[model samples]
Target: MSWREEHRSNLELKMGKVVRLLGECEQQLIDETDPPTKSRLKSQISELKGQMRDCQGDLDSFGQEQVTQRNLALTMASVTYEDINFVITALLNQRMISIDGQDNFQPTNPEEKMYKNDLTHNIKFFLDMGLAKAGEVRHFVENNAKINFPDVPERLKASLNTEYIKLIRSGMRGDELFMHLYKFSSHNNPDPLRQAAGLAVLCYFFETCDVFEP
Candidate 1:
């Protein structure tokens, strides 16, 4: 099996053990009446809960990575409208677009046309031109993944749309815009898997496509 698969399997095993232990600890808490012993058990339970959460998070990340890798590989091998649709669907499901009362990273369209049209154009551009160089996709993914949008300066946020338009007009193409959107989405959602998936879709686009210029 691949390292990724093996890692996931190991995590699953570890999670199983932790879950079993947590159950035991809960039982102990119920059975024990001594104050000092109960306190110790409670502490252990809390620690176990934290561990479980960590394990779950790791598992989730692994799953997202797998999906992203698969889709990227497919896109690189075969550039097609269907693959593009897949990427779009993944982004939407991951909340890269807005929902009621929940802000996302979707750019404000100055034209005010259908949002999907803008997304489609951007995604197609990245697939066609953004990944022209070796390792470009990897670099883009690494850099953008590190961004936490909430920590950005308020001044920047206030003029994000204007700045984005300027950048687009000034030769900023597919990969760059995608990264911007991905970071914004991640900041709003605060879910690692969802963010990873969005990035993966963009990476897939970057990996595919024959056209290398805007």
Candidate 2:
């Protein structure tokens, strides 16, 4: 399932549970006429209401902050090193990049190499998965971006460019800027392939747009 869908499902599940508990509390509070018992039930009901509010707040944040990708969280879990390596090889074959003996992208400049070298595996990891799904992941990413960015490719490029400019102005070096972009894209996710997917998408944009310079 897509990450967005899964996240929504979890939030909905929590909301449902909170609502059910709230109903049970209200019913018990109404049935208990004893002053002390009623007071306890009221306290319990209040807590449940607070929990319900918290759940609602989380749902709202999910709606607002998690704007865009419906990433294939489950699909990413099964990727292997060999699969990523093959994708890297394919990229090299396509003349998208040149590889060294260690199979890392050999960019022309030291700065470019420093920026992309550390995340070589991660970039390849998502590339393999994206193409394997017949570009399903890639298509959804663009589709999702279209919600706020009507210009499709150009809007996407502008968004990344803004971030790149901000990072540069903030005194971040090439390597640091690259890492910032990766983490920003991944939402600092702990999942390996998911994080890799973030880098892969960034790499895609870099190729198709002018986000970074050599």
Candidate 3:
């Protein structure tokens, strides 16, 4: 097993022990009539539950770290959409993002709060790579949406638009909305490259086609 998987296994085992201990403490408190002893047991149970929560959080972070590693691997590609995503998110985060559309000139009309501060880490995470070759992945995506990778724009919009709007209307924060969008597009696919592509598609749509107004 990978070290992360093994570490998660160990955490699971530790969590199991904490749960059993918590159960025992609760049972002891139920049976013990002594007030001070019951208070001590209550405190112990609370601590055990906190340990369980921390362990679960560690386990969750480990899973996300695996995705981070996978995306890091994708950065080695000659042309990377992550760079495109970085540019768009960084511009939005800075309140200076603008996009000229066919006629209306979208100007990336996002709610100020949706972009400022919300995408700092989102931009930082991709910038952390600093390995993405300077390329016009965004321009490529825009130009070829109907020619080279014809399916991408249509398919991405068809797959994501309605839910993207729903998520925005639901008042979900930007980063959280992106996570849900990523999972929706990725669909738990196990392939790393596909995951990267899925993320690129989502980020691209975020810039051009989706509703970020709420």
lDDT of each: 0.43, 0.49, 0.49
What is the Å distance of residue 214 in model 2 from its true position? 5.6
**Candidate 1, which ten residues in sequence have the lowest lDDT sum?**
205-214
Model 3: per-residue Cα lDDT at residue 47: 91
Q: What is the C-alpha RMSD of each candidate to the true structure, in Å?
A: 17.7, 19.7, 20.1
Model 1 segments beyond 4 Å from truth?
A: 64-214
- Candidate 2, residue 102: lDDT: 22
Residues 42-141, candidate 3: write the lDDT tens digits. 8997898688667656766767754553334333232234434443333223221233221222435333424652754444333222212212334445
Q: List the residue pairs that clash in candidate 2.
A: none
Model 2: lDDT of residue 173: 58
Model 2 agreement with the true structure over 1-214: per-residue lDDT tens digits: 8998677667555554554455456546646789999998889878876775565566666654322211332333233343333332332232122212222232344224335544343233233333233233344445545674444444444555566767777887545577687665554667666555555556555543345653
All candidates' TM-scores?
0.30, 0.35, 0.40
